[model samples]
Target: MAKVLVIAGDFVEDYELMVPFQALQAMGHEVLAVCPDKSAGDKIKTAIHDFEGDQTYSEKPGHAFTLNASFADVSESQFDALVIPGGRAPEYLRLNPAVIDMVCAFAASAKPIAAICHGAQLLAAAKIIEGKKVSAYPACAPEVKLAGGDYADIAVDDAITDGNLVTAPAWPAHPAWLKQFNELLNK
Candidate 1:
């Protein structure tokens, strides 16, 4: 079984974070959830982003998710794969140098990386997606392109995998995203 590391932060999309964390565990993988500056037993608030006939997704308060590991203790070599959930959190997480370095380490090693929606922000900040085809929330297309990655304008419920990276536009693509990621981990 793969030891998966999930990097998340406050306001991470509720479904994007919770679903994969739980589903992967259910699939017999050892999963560890962490947030920068937070330790095990700490909780991070989540936000639900739903497409409610508006120009963009609408946000609502979501459940408080507990951290199972401390970011300070995270070492890239300790895990086999990385998962980054999207939401407002990525906007701030991308500004942390340590977070950027961590993502780069995972990419450099060719570890399986699954990023959804705004999660592309972190990948772009890490500058690891160059020449790759990445899918993220439509609004993040510019950042993906600026980072030298080809933006995959996929459907919200679709996912795409390139090399060691598996990406999707949003939580709606969880099934496809997680499935592709799981396959990468097994490889």
Candidate 2:
């Protein structure tokens, strides 16, 4: 089983973070959930983003998710794959130099990387998606393109895999995202 590292932060989409973390474990993989400046047992608040009749997704307060590992303890080489969940969190997480470096390391190694929705913001900030076809929330398409990536305008429930990276637009694509990511891990 692969040891996967999930990088997340406060206000991360509720289902995007929780589902993968739990589902990966259920699939027999070892998963570690972490947040910047936080340690094991520490918690981060989540938000539920739902699509309604509005222009954008609606946000509601979600559960407090506990971190299972410390960000400072993360060593890129220690994990086999990386997962980045989408939400308002990525908007700020991209500003952290350490976070950018970490994402770069994962990309440099060609390890399996799964990013969804606003998580592309981090990939854009890291400047590691150049020439790759990446899918993210429609709002993030410009960033993906500006970062030199080919934005995949895929269905909300679909996912696309390019090389070692597997990306999707949102949590609705979880089934396809995880399936593709799991295949990459097994390879």
Error of 2 at 77 (Å): 1.0
Model 2 Cα lDDT, one tens digit per residue, 14-57: 99999999999999999999999999999999999999989999
lDDT of each: 0.97, 0.97
Count of steric clashes across candidates, in order: 0, 0
Question: Cα deviation in Å at residue 92, candidate 2?
Answer: 0.4
Show pairs that collide, candidate 2: none
TM-score of 1: 0.99
lDDT of 1: 0.97
Give the TM-score comparing model 2 with the true structure, all chains together.
0.99
lDDT of 1 by residue, 1-187 (tens): 9999999999999999999999999999999999999999999999999999999999999999999999999989999999999999999999999999899999999999999999999999999999999999999999999999999999999999999999999999999999999999998
What are the runs in model 2 whose C-alpha is more than 4 Å off?
none
